[model samples]
Target: MAALGLSGCSSSEDGGVLTVAGSTTVMPIAEMAAEQFEEETGTKVLVSGLGSSAGIEAVQNGTADIATSSRGLTEAEAATDLVTTVVALDGIAVIVNDDNPVSGLTMDQLRSIYAGETTNWSEVGGDDLQILVVNRDEASGTREAFKKIVMDGTPFDRSAAVLPGTGQVRDVVSRTAGAIGYISIGFVASDFTSSTVKSLAIDGVAATEENVENGTYPVSRDLYFFTKGDPSGKVEDYIELVLSDEMSQTIRDAGYLPLSDASYQARAKAAGAEEGGDAS
Candidate 1:
Protein backbone atom coordinates (compact mmCIF):
# COMPACT_ATOMS: atom_id res chain seq x y z
CA MET A 1 0.00 0.00 0.00
CA ALA A 2 1.15 3.57 -0.69
CA ALA A 3 1.21 6.44 1.88
CA LEU A 4 1.47 10.16 1.17
CA GLY A 5 1.98 13.75 2.43
CA LEU A 6 5.44 14.15 3.94
CA SER A 7 9.10 15.06 3.24
CA GLY A 8 9.10 13.98 -0.42
CA CYS A 9 7.14 16.89 -1.89
CA SER A 10 9.22 17.68 -4.96
CA SER A 11 7.21 20.07 -7.15
CA SER A 12 8.08 17.84 -10.04
CA GLU A 13 6.51 14.79 -8.36
CA ASP A 14 3.80 12.94 -10.27
CA GLY A 15 1.06 15.25 -11.52
CA GLY A 16 -1.62 12.61 -11.49
CA VAL A 17 -4.77 12.84 -9.37
CA LEU A 18 -4.82 11.21 -5.93
CA THR A 19 -8.01 9.57 -4.71
CA VAL A 20 -9.33 10.19 -1.18
CA ALA A 21 -12.38 8.92 0.66
CA GLY A 22 -14.00 9.47 4.05
CA SER A 23 -16.18 11.52 6.35
CA THR A 24 -18.97 13.62 4.93
CA THR A 25 -18.43 15.81 7.96
CA VAL A 26 -15.02 16.59 6.49
CA MET A 27 -16.24 16.87 2.89
CA PRO A 28 -16.63 20.65 2.71
CA ILE A 29 -13.14 21.31 3.97
CA ALA A 30 -11.63 18.59 1.81
CA GLU A 31 -13.39 19.88 -1.29
CA MET A 32 -12.28 23.45 -0.70
CA ALA A 33 -8.74 22.42 0.16
CA ALA A 34 -8.57 20.17 -2.88
CA GLU A 35 -9.84 22.99 -5.09
CA GLN A 36 -7.18 25.36 -3.82
CA PHE A 37 -4.50 22.72 -4.08
CA GLU A 38 -5.48 21.94 -7.65
CA GLU A 39 -5.50 25.60 -8.64
CA GLU A 40 -2.12 26.30 -7.10
CA THR A 41 -0.33 23.08 -8.07
CA GLY A 42 -2.24 21.80 -11.10
CA THR A 43 -2.52 18.32 -9.61
CA LYS A 44 -5.86 16.67 -8.96
CA VAL A 45 -7.17 15.64 -5.53
CA LEU A 46 -10.31 13.59 -5.68
CA VAL A 47 -12.18 13.20 -2.38
CA SER A 48 -15.11 10.93 -1.60
CA GLY A 49 -17.70 11.06 1.24
CA LEU A 50 -18.00 7.40 2.07
CA GLY A 51 -17.58 7.70 5.86
CA SER A 52 -14.40 7.19 7.91
CA SER A 53 -14.35 3.42 7.99
CA ALA A 54 -14.72 3.24 4.24
CA GLY A 55 -11.88 5.70 3.75
CA ILE A 56 -9.53 3.67 5.96
CA GLU A 57 -10.67 0.57 4.15
CA ALA A 58 -9.99 2.27 0.83
CA VAL A 59 -6.41 2.98 1.90
CA GLN A 60 -5.86 -0.44 3.42
CA ASN A 61 -7.10 -2.00 0.19
CA GLY A 62 -4.89 0.14 -2.08
CA THR A 63 -7.74 2.21 -3.45
CA ALA A 64 -6.93 5.70 -2.17
CA ASP A 65 -3.99 8.00 -1.51
CA ILE A 66 -5.56 9.67 1.51
CA ALA A 67 -8.52 8.96 3.76
CA THR A 68 -10.22 11.93 5.37
CA SER A 69 -12.03 11.40 8.66
CA SER A 70 -13.57 13.37 11.52
CA ARG A 71 -12.63 10.53 13.87
CA GLY A 72 -9.49 8.49 14.28
CA LEU A 73 -9.19 5.04 12.85
CA THR A 74 -9.82 2.16 15.22
CA GLU A 75 -6.71 0.32 16.31
CA ALA A 76 -7.87 -2.60 14.21
CA GLU A 77 -8.01 -0.28 11.20
CA ALA A 78 -4.42 0.91 11.62
CA ALA A 79 -2.61 -2.38 11.50
CA THR A 80 0.58 -2.80 9.45
CA ASP A 81 1.93 0.18 7.52
CA LEU A 82 -1.12 2.41 7.67
CA VAL A 83 -0.44 5.89 9.03
CA THR A 84 -2.85 8.48 10.47
CA THR A 85 -2.70 12.26 10.21
CA VAL A 86 -4.81 14.75 12.19
CA VAL A 87 -5.51 18.01 10.36
CA ALA A 88 -8.01 20.05 12.36
CA LEU A 89 -10.36 20.22 15.32
CA ASP A 90 -14.10 19.90 14.76
CA GLY A 91 -16.93 20.99 17.09
CA ILE A 92 -19.86 18.65 16.88
CA ALA A 93 -23.14 20.53 17.22
CA VAL A 94 -26.35 19.19 18.63
CA ILE A 95 -29.21 20.20 16.35
CA VAL A 96 -32.97 20.19 16.69
CA ASN A 97 -35.80 21.52 14.62
CA ASP A 98 -36.12 25.30 14.65
CA ASP A 99 -39.40 24.83 16.44
CA ASN A 100 -37.69 23.18 19.36
CA PRO A 101 -36.98 25.66 22.12
CA VAL A 102 -34.11 24.03 23.92
CA SER A 103 -30.89 26.04 24.00
CA GLY A 104 -28.58 23.52 25.66
CA LEU A 105 -28.28 20.02 26.98
CA THR A 106 -26.33 18.43 29.77
CA MET A 107 -24.24 15.47 28.68
CA ASP A 108 -26.47 13.19 30.67
CA GLN A 109 -29.54 14.59 28.96
CA LEU A 110 -28.01 14.04 25.56
CA ARG A 111 -27.24 10.46 26.43
CA SER A 112 -30.73 9.90 27.71
CA ILE A 113 -32.34 11.40 24.63
CA TYR A 114 -30.26 9.40 22.19
CA ALA A 115 -30.78 6.30 24.25
CA GLY A 116 -34.54 6.98 24.05
CA GLU A 117 -35.04 7.67 27.74
CA THR A 118 -36.07 11.27 27.22
CA THR A 119 -38.58 11.00 24.43
CA ASN A 120 -40.49 14.25 24.78
CA TRP A 121 -39.48 17.75 23.89
CA SER A 122 -40.85 18.87 27.22
CA GLU A 123 -38.26 16.78 28.93
CA VAL A 124 -35.64 19.19 27.67
CA GLY A 125 -37.52 22.52 27.93
CA GLY A 126 -39.12 22.40 24.51
CA ASP A 127 -42.70 22.15 23.27
CA ASP A 128 -44.67 19.33 24.74
CA LEU A 129 -44.25 16.99 21.80
CA GLN A 130 -42.74 13.59 21.32
CA ILE A 131 -39.07 13.99 20.53
CA LEU A 132 -37.89 12.48 17.28
CA VAL A 133 -34.29 11.32 17.04
CA VAL A 134 -32.23 11.18 13.89
CA ASN A 135 -28.84 9.57 13.92
CA ARG A 136 -25.93 9.00 11.56
CA ASP A 137 -25.55 5.61 9.97
CA GLU A 138 -23.26 3.08 11.61
CA ALA A 139 -20.35 3.74 9.24
CA SER A 140 -20.06 7.39 10.16
CA GLY A 141 -17.11 8.42 12.29
CA THR A 142 -19.23 11.29 13.54
CA ARG A 143 -21.67 8.69 14.72
CA GLU A 144 -18.97 6.76 16.49
CA ALA A 145 -17.54 9.93 18.01
CA PHE A 146 -20.93 11.05 19.20
CA LYS A 147 -21.54 7.63 20.65
CA LYS A 148 -18.17 7.49 22.31
CA ILE A 149 -18.59 10.83 23.99
CA VAL A 150 -22.27 10.87 24.86
CA MET A 151 -23.41 7.28 24.98
CA ASP A 152 -20.37 5.92 26.75
CA GLY A 153 -20.67 2.56 24.99
CA THR A 154 -24.34 2.33 25.80
CA PRO A 155 -26.42 1.17 22.86
CA PHE A 156 -28.30 3.75 20.90
CA ASP A 157 -32.01 3.27 20.94
CA ARG A 158 -33.18 0.89 18.24
CA SER A 159 -36.12 3.16 17.60
CA ALA A 160 -33.96 6.15 16.66
CA ALA A 161 -33.89 6.71 12.93
CA VAL A 162 -30.39 5.90 11.67
CA LEU A 163 -29.84 7.91 8.51
CA PRO A 164 -26.95 7.85 6.09
CA GLY A 165 -24.54 10.82 5.95
CA THR A 166 -24.46 14.16 7.73
CA GLY A 167 -26.53 15.80 5.01
CA GLN A 168 -29.33 13.34 5.48
CA VAL A 169 -29.36 13.77 9.23
CA ARG A 170 -29.56 17.53 8.84
CA ASP A 171 -32.35 17.27 6.32
CA VAL A 172 -34.42 15.01 8.51
CA VAL A 173 -34.10 17.16 11.62
CA SER A 174 -34.76 20.31 9.63
CA ARG A 175 -37.96 18.94 8.18
CA THR A 176 -39.37 16.81 10.96
CA ALA A 177 -41.14 18.50 13.78
CA GLY A 178 -39.61 17.78 17.19
CA ALA A 179 -36.64 16.16 15.46
CA ILE A 180 -33.13 16.30 16.84
CA GLY A 181 -29.82 15.35 15.28
CA TYR A 182 -26.14 16.03 15.63
CA ILE A 183 -24.11 17.56 12.80
CA SER A 184 -20.89 19.40 12.16
CA ILE A 185 -21.13 23.12 12.76
CA GLY A 186 -20.30 23.94 9.13
CA PHE A 187 -23.36 22.31 7.67
CA VAL A 188 -25.65 24.48 9.78
CA ALA A 189 -26.63 26.58 6.77
CA SER A 190 -28.66 29.76 6.45
CA ASP A 191 -31.87 27.78 6.52
CA PHE A 192 -31.05 26.69 10.00
CA THR A 193 -30.12 30.22 10.94
CA SER A 194 -32.86 31.98 12.94
CA SER A 195 -34.94 28.86 12.62
CA THR A 196 -36.74 27.08 15.42
CA VAL A 197 -34.13 24.42 15.04
CA LYS A 198 -31.04 25.62 16.86
CA SER A 199 -27.72 24.31 18.07
CA LEU A 200 -27.68 23.13 21.65
CA ALA A 201 -24.81 23.58 24.03
CA ILE A 202 -23.42 20.35 25.37
CA ASP A 203 -22.69 20.06 29.07
CA GLY A 204 -23.33 23.77 29.41
CA VAL A 205 -20.69 24.42 26.79
CA ALA A 206 -21.35 25.86 23.36
CA ALA A 207 -19.63 24.53 20.31
CA THR A 208 -17.59 27.39 18.97
CA GLU A 209 -14.04 28.20 17.84
CA GLU A 210 -13.29 29.78 21.19
CA ASN A 211 -14.79 26.92 23.13
CA VAL A 212 -13.18 24.21 21.02
CA GLU A 213 -9.76 25.84 21.05
CA ASN A 214 -9.76 26.33 24.79
CA GLY A 215 -11.06 22.81 25.31
CA THR A 216 -14.19 24.13 26.98
CA TYR A 217 -16.52 22.40 24.59
CA PRO A 218 -17.53 18.88 25.51
CA VAL A 219 -17.94 17.64 21.95
CA SER A 220 -14.84 18.27 19.94
CA ARG A 221 -12.30 16.00 18.28
CA ASP A 222 -9.47 16.06 15.78
CA LEU A 223 -10.09 15.63 12.08
CA TYR A 224 -7.88 13.26 10.13
CA PHE A 225 -6.24 12.26 6.84
CA PHE A 226 -4.99 8.70 6.80
CA THR A 227 -2.51 6.96 4.55
CA LYS A 228 -0.58 3.75 4.44
CA GLY A 229 2.94 3.96 5.95
CA ASP A 230 4.95 7.15 5.85
CA PRO A 231 3.95 9.47 3.04
CA SER A 232 6.36 10.05 0.19
CA GLY A 233 6.44 11.69 -3.23
CA LYS A 234 3.43 13.88 -4.08
CA VAL A 235 1.60 12.72 -0.98
CA GLU A 236 4.31 14.17 1.21
CA ASP A 237 4.22 17.42 -0.73
CA TYR A 238 0.47 17.83 -0.40
CA ILE A 239 0.35 17.07 3.28
CA GLU A 240 3.17 19.48 3.96
CA LEU A 241 1.32 22.16 2.05
CA VAL A 242 -1.76 21.50 4.12
CA LEU A 243 0.10 21.98 7.38
CA SER A 244 1.06 25.55 6.48
CA ASP A 245 -0.34 28.56 8.31
CA GLU A 246 -2.44 29.40 5.29
CA MET A 247 -4.01 25.96 5.38
CA SER A 248 -4.91 26.40 9.03
CA GLN A 249 -6.88 29.45 7.98
CA THR A 250 -8.75 27.26 5.54
CA ILE A 251 -9.43 24.89 8.39
CA ARG A 252 -11.19 27.63 10.39
CA ASP A 253 -13.31 28.75 7.43
CA ALA A 254 -14.39 25.18 6.88
CA GLY A 255 -16.25 25.42 10.25
CA TYR A 256 -13.57 23.63 12.21
CA LEU A 257 -11.12 25.38 14.52
CA PRO A 258 -7.51 25.95 13.48
CA LEU A 259 -4.66 24.75 15.61
CA SER A 260 -3.09 27.64 17.50
CA ASP A 261 0.18 29.04 16.19
CA ALA A 262 2.01 27.38 19.03
CA SER A 263 0.09 24.15 18.55
CA TYR A 264 0.51 24.10 14.80
CA GLN A 265 4.12 25.19 14.97
CA ALA A 266 4.96 22.40 17.34
CA ARG A 267 3.16 19.93 15.11
CA ALA A 268 4.97 21.16 11.99
CA LYS A 269 8.29 21.19 13.81
CA ALA A 270 8.01 17.54 14.72
CA ALA A 271 10.11 15.13 12.66
CA GLY A 272 8.28 13.11 10.06
CA ALA A 273 5.34 15.40 10.68
CA GLU A 274 3.55 13.97 7.70
CA GLU A 275 -0.08 12.90 7.43
CA GLY A 276 0.64 10.10 9.87
CA GLY A 277 2.25 11.95 12.74
CA ASP A 278 0.69 11.69 16.19
CA ALA A 279 -1.51 14.65 15.36
CA SER A 280 -1.16 15.67 11.76
Candidate 2:
Protein backbone atom coordinates (compact mmCIF):
# COMPACT_ATOMS: atom_id res chain seq x y z
CA MET A 1 0.00 0.00 0.00
CA ALA A 2 1.13 3.55 -0.68
CA ALA A 3 1.52 6.23 1.96
CA LEU A 4 -1.52 8.44 2.60
CA GLY A 5 -0.84 12.00 1.63
CA LEU A 6 -1.99 14.86 3.84
CA SER A 7 -3.54 17.97 2.32
CA GLY A 8 -1.65 20.77 4.10
CA CYS A 9 -0.26 20.92 7.57
CA SER A 10 -0.73 17.97 9.92
CA SER A 11 -3.64 20.02 11.20
CA SER A 12 -5.60 21.90 8.62
CA GLU A 13 -6.11 25.62 8.92
CA ASP A 14 -9.88 25.40 8.73
CA GLY A 15 -11.65 22.79 10.90
CA GLY A 16 -8.38 20.82 11.26
CA VAL A 17 -7.26 17.40 9.98
CA LEU A 18 -5.19 14.61 11.49
CA THR A 19 -3.48 12.11 9.21
CA VAL A 20 -2.70 8.67 10.63
CA ALA A 21 -0.99 5.91 8.73
CA GLY A 22 0.60 2.54 9.53
CA SER A 23 -0.02 -0.95 10.83
CA THR A 24 -3.05 -2.76 9.41
CA THR A 25 -3.62 -4.15 12.92
CA VAL A 26 -4.03 -0.63 14.26
CA MET A 27 -5.95 0.66 11.22
CA PRO A 28 -9.43 -0.50 12.29
CA ILE A 29 -9.15 1.04 15.76
CA ALA A 30 -7.74 4.27 14.34
CA GLU A 31 -10.56 4.48 11.78
CA MET A 32 -13.21 3.97 14.47
CA ALA A 33 -11.59 6.56 16.71
CA ALA A 34 -11.20 8.95 13.78
CA GLU A 35 -14.88 8.67 12.94
CA GLN A 36 -15.89 9.39 16.51
CA PHE A 37 -13.43 12.26 16.75
CA GLU A 38 -14.72 13.82 13.53
CA GLU A 39 -18.32 13.58 14.72
CA GLU A 40 -17.57 14.97 18.16
CA THR A 41 -14.96 17.59 17.38
CA GLY A 42 -15.58 18.31 13.68
CA THR A 43 -11.96 17.56 12.81
CA LYS A 44 -11.31 15.61 9.64
CA VAL A 45 -9.07 12.61 10.32
CA LEU A 46 -7.52 10.60 7.50
CA VAL A 47 -6.19 7.13 8.32
CA SER A 48 -4.33 4.67 6.13
CA GLY A 49 -2.89 1.17 6.54
CA LEU A 50 0.26 1.07 4.44
CA GLY A 51 2.20 -1.11 6.93
CA SER A 52 4.12 -0.09 10.09
CA SER A 53 7.31 0.89 8.34
CA ALA A 54 5.50 3.22 5.97
CA GLY A 55 3.69 4.79 8.89
CA ILE A 56 6.97 5.47 10.69
CA GLU A 57 8.38 6.97 7.55
CA ALA A 58 5.32 9.15 7.05
CA VAL A 59 5.75 10.60 10.52
CA GLN A 60 9.46 11.05 10.05
CA ASN A 61 8.98 12.83 6.74
CA GLY A 62 6.18 15.04 8.10
CA THR A 63 3.59 13.46 5.83
CA ALA A 64 1.47 12.16 8.66
CA ASP A 65 0.39 13.69 11.95
CA ILE A 66 0.44 10.31 13.69
CA ALA A 67 1.89 6.91 12.93
CA THR A 68 -0.02 3.93 14.27
CA SER A 69 2.22 0.92 14.91
CA SER A 70 1.39 -2.52 16.26
CA ARG A 71 4.95 -2.95 17.52
CA GLY A 72 7.04 -0.66 19.67
CA LEU A 73 9.53 1.67 17.98
CA THR A 74 13.21 0.74 17.95
CA GLU A 75 15.79 2.77 19.84
CA ALA A 76 17.01 4.35 16.59
CA GLU A 77 13.49 5.44 15.62
CA ALA A 78 12.80 6.63 19.17
CA ALA A 79 15.95 8.77 19.09
CA THR A 80 14.72 10.71 16.07
CA ASP A 81 12.52 13.13 18.02
CA LEU A 82 9.56 10.78 18.06
CA VAL A 83 7.15 10.13 20.91
CA THR A 84 5.17 6.91 21.20
CA THR A 85 2.04 6.47 23.26
CA VAL A 86 0.81 3.00 24.08
CA VAL A 87 -2.82 3.06 23.10
CA ALA A 88 -3.75 -0.58 23.68
CA LEU A 89 -2.39 -4.06 24.25
CA ASP A 90 -2.64 -6.85 21.67
CA GLY A 91 -1.97 -10.59 21.63
CA ILE A 92 -0.60 -12.27 18.54
CA ALA A 93 -2.94 -15.24 18.03
CA VAL A 94 -1.94 -18.21 15.96
CA ILE A 95 -4.91 -19.05 13.75
CA VAL A 96 -5.91 -22.03 11.69
CA ASN A 97 -8.79 -23.11 9.49
CA ASP A 98 -11.94 -23.88 11.49
CA ASP A 99 -12.09 -27.36 10.01
CA ASN A 100 -8.84 -28.32 11.73
CA PRO A 101 -9.53 -30.52 14.74
CA VAL A 102 -6.36 -29.59 16.55
CA SER A 103 -7.12 -27.08 19.29
CA GLY A 104 -3.90 -25.79 20.83
CA LEU A 105 -0.13 -25.87 20.40
CA THR A 106 2.92 -25.75 22.64
CA MET A 107 5.53 -23.04 22.11
CA ASP A 108 8.01 -25.62 20.95
CA GLN A 109 5.52 -27.06 18.48
CA LEU A 110 4.80 -23.64 17.13
CA ARG A 111 8.50 -22.93 16.81
CA SER A 112 9.07 -26.16 14.96
CA ILE A 113 6.19 -25.59 12.56
CA TYR A 114 7.32 -22.12 11.56
CA ALA A 115 10.91 -23.14 11.41
CA GLY A 116 10.14 -25.81 8.75
CA GLU A 117 11.15 -28.59 11.15
CA THR A 118 7.58 -29.95 11.23
CA THR A 119 6.01 -30.27 7.81
CA ASN A 120 2.90 -32.32 8.49
CA TRP A 121 -0.18 -31.66 10.59
CA SER A 122 0.01 -35.25 11.91
CA GLU A 123 3.38 -34.42 13.41
CA VAL A 124 1.51 -32.24 15.91
CA GLY A 125 -1.50 -34.53 16.47
CA GLY A 126 -3.64 -33.40 13.59
CA ASP A 127 -4.81 -35.00 10.34
CA ASP A 128 -2.23 -36.33 7.94
CA LEU A 129 -1.70 -33.41 5.59
CA GLN A 130 1.10 -31.08 4.62
CA ILE A 131 0.96 -27.98 6.80
CA LEU A 132 0.91 -24.82 4.69
CA VAL A 133 2.46 -21.87 6.45
CA VAL A 134 1.39 -18.29 5.82
CA ASN A 135 3.50 -15.41 7.02
CA ARG A 136 3.58 -11.61 6.91
CA ASP A 137 6.09 -9.78 4.80
CA GLU A 138 9.30 -8.34 6.29
CA ALA A 139 7.80 -4.84 6.58
CA SER A 140 4.92 -6.01 8.71
CA GLY A 141 5.10 -5.25 12.40
CA THR A 142 3.00 -8.33 13.08
CA ARG A 143 5.66 -10.50 11.49
CA GLU A 144 8.40 -8.80 13.51
CA ALA A 145 6.52 -9.26 16.76
CA PHE A 146 5.74 -12.88 15.94
CA LYS A 147 9.42 -13.55 15.31
CA LYS A 148 10.49 -11.92 18.56
CA ILE A 149 7.84 -13.53 20.77
CA VAL A 150 7.44 -16.92 19.14
CA MET A 151 10.19 -17.68 16.65
CA ASP A 152 13.01 -16.37 18.92
CA GLY A 153 15.25 -15.37 15.94
CA THR A 154 14.32 -18.52 14.05
CA PRO A 155 13.29 -17.88 10.46
CA PHE A 156 9.96 -18.71 8.92
CA ASP A 157 9.78 -21.75 6.69
CA ARG A 158 11.28 -21.08 3.28
CA SER A 159 8.08 -22.30 1.68
CA ALA A 160 5.83 -20.12 3.81
CA ALA A 161 3.65 -17.81 1.76
CA VAL A 162 4.42 -14.21 2.72
CA LEU A 163 1.40 -11.90 2.58
CA PRO A 164 1.21 -8.17 3.24
CA GLY A 165 -1.39 -7.64 5.95
CA THR A 166 -3.40 -9.38 8.67
CA GLY A 167 -6.60 -9.43 6.61
CA GLN A 168 -4.92 -11.37 3.84
CA VAL A 169 -3.40 -13.81 6.30
CA ARG A 170 -6.74 -14.43 8.03
CA ASP A 171 -8.56 -14.85 4.73
CA VAL A 172 -5.99 -17.25 3.36
CA VAL A 173 -5.80 -19.38 6.52
CA SER A 174 -9.57 -19.61 6.84
CA ARG A 175 -9.91 -21.20 3.41
CA THR A 176 -6.83 -23.41 3.26
CA ALA A 177 -7.50 -26.61 5.16
CA GLY A 178 -3.95 -27.20 6.39
CA ALA A 179 -2.86 -23.59 6.58
CA ILE A 180 -1.85 -21.68 9.70
CA GLY A 181 -1.04 -18.00 10.29
CA TYR A 182 -0.63 -15.55 13.14
CA ILE A 183 -2.47 -12.26 13.62
CA SER A 184 -3.45 -9.74 16.23
CA ILE A 185 -5.94 -11.32 18.62
CA GLY A 186 -8.31 -8.45 17.85
CA PHE A 187 -8.66 -9.80 14.33
CA VAL A 188 -10.12 -13.01 15.76
CA ALA A 189 -13.60 -12.99 17.20
CA SER A 190 -13.85 -13.00 20.96
CA ASP A 191 -15.90 -16.13 20.44
CA PHE A 192 -15.13 -18.61 17.67
CA THR A 193 -18.73 -19.26 16.61
CA SER A 194 -18.68 -16.54 13.94
CA SER A 195 -15.16 -16.91 12.68
CA THR A 196 -13.89 -19.05 9.81
CA VAL A 197 -10.44 -18.97 11.43
CA LYS A 198 -9.85 -20.20 14.98
CA SER A 199 -7.19 -18.84 17.31
CA LEU A 200 -5.11 -21.48 19.09
CA ALA A 201 -4.14 -21.25 22.73
CA ILE A 202 -0.43 -21.37 23.41
CA ASP A 203 0.43 -23.84 26.13
CA GLY A 204 -3.26 -23.95 27.11
CA VAL A 205 -3.43 -20.26 27.96
CA ALA A 206 -6.20 -18.61 25.97
CA ALA A 207 -5.59 -15.32 24.15
CA THR A 208 -7.99 -13.18 26.10
CA GLU A 209 -7.77 -9.51 26.99
CA GLU A 210 -7.67 -10.42 30.64
CA ASN A 211 -4.87 -12.89 29.97
CA VAL A 212 -2.89 -10.35 27.92
CA GLU A 213 -3.33 -7.68 30.61
CA ASN A 214 -2.32 -10.11 33.33
CA GLY A 215 0.77 -11.15 31.36
CA THR A 216 -0.37 -14.77 31.22
CA TYR A 217 -0.82 -14.83 27.46
CA PRO A 218 2.48 -15.82 25.89
CA VAL A 219 2.32 -13.60 22.78
CA SER A 220 1.05 -10.21 23.80
CA ARG A 221 2.54 -6.83 22.92
CA ASP A 222 1.84 -3.15 23.21
CA LEU A 223 0.15 -1.22 20.36
CA TYR A 224 1.60 2.23 19.78
CA PHE A 225 0.90 5.60 18.10
CA PHE A 226 3.96 7.63 17.19
CA THR A 227 4.33 11.34 16.63
CA LYS A 228 7.26 13.17 15.09
CA GLY A 229 7.53 15.17 18.27
CA ASP A 230 5.25 16.21 21.11
CA PRO A 231 1.65 15.91 19.97
CA SER A 232 -0.35 19.11 20.13
CA GLY A 233 -3.72 20.41 18.87
CA LYS A 234 -5.75 17.85 16.95
CA VAL A 235 -3.06 15.21 17.19
CA GLU A 236 -3.03 15.40 20.96
CA ASP A 237 -6.83 15.42 21.10
CA TYR A 238 -7.11 12.33 18.94
CA ILE A 239 -4.53 10.47 21.02
CA GLU A 240 -6.37 11.46 24.18
CA LEU A 241 -9.63 10.21 22.74
CA VAL A 242 -8.10 6.86 21.88
CA LEU A 243 -6.90 6.42 25.46
CA SER A 244 -10.11 7.69 27.03
CA ASP A 245 -12.78 5.59 28.79
CA GLU A 246 -15.19 6.47 26.01
CA MET A 247 -13.18 4.33 23.61
CA SER A 248 -12.81 1.32 25.91
CA GLN A 249 -15.78 -0.47 24.40
CA THR A 250 -14.55 0.34 20.89
CA ILE A 251 -11.18 -1.14 21.83
CA ARG A 252 -12.86 -4.31 23.11
CA ASP A 253 -15.12 -4.46 20.10
CA ALA A 254 -12.05 -4.19 17.89
CA GLY A 255 -10.59 -7.18 19.81
CA TYR A 256 -7.88 -5.29 21.74
CA LEU A 257 -7.21 -4.74 25.42
CA PRO A 258 -7.89 -1.20 26.57
CA LEU A 259 -5.27 0.47 28.70
CA SER A 260 -5.82 0.64 32.42
CA ASP A 261 -5.77 3.95 34.28
CA ALA A 262 -2.24 3.29 35.46
CA SER A 263 -1.02 2.49 31.97
CA TYR A 264 -2.74 5.53 30.56
CA GLN A 265 -1.24 7.79 33.20
CA ALA A 266 2.20 6.38 32.66
CA ARG A 267 2.05 6.99 28.92
CA ALA A 268 0.77 10.50 29.45
CA LYS A 269 3.50 11.21 31.97
CA ALA A 270 6.18 9.79 29.74
CA ALA A 271 5.06 11.83 26.75
CA GLY A 272 4.95 14.95 28.89
CA ALA A 273 8.42 14.32 30.20
CA GLU A 274 9.79 13.84 26.70
CA GLU A 275 8.18 17.04 25.52
CA GLY A 276 9.60 18.93 28.48
CA GLY A 277 13.07 17.61 27.82
CA ASP A 278 12.84 18.45 24.14
CA ALA A 279 11.93 22.05 25.00
CA SER A 280 14.91 22.36 27.33
TM-score of each: 0.86, 0.88
lDDT of 1 by residue, 1-280 (tens): 1323321231223546767678888877778778888898777777778888887777787677778888876777755677877777777889987766788989999999999999998887878899888988888999989988889988899998989887778777888888889988767664544433468888888877677666678887778888888888767777776766777778777777655457534534552355445535
Per-residue lDDT of 68 in model 2:
88
- Please report the candidate that would top lDDT against the real structure: 2
RMSD of each: 5.6, 4.5
- lDDT (Cα, 0-100) at 27 in candidate 1: 79
Model 1, residue 142: displacement in angstroms?
0.2
Instruction: Show pairs that collide, candidate 2.
Output: none
- Where model 2 places Cα greater than 4 Å from the true spot, the runs are 1-3, 8-15, 190-195, 261-280
**Model 2 clashing-pair count:** 0
lDDT of 1 at 26: 81
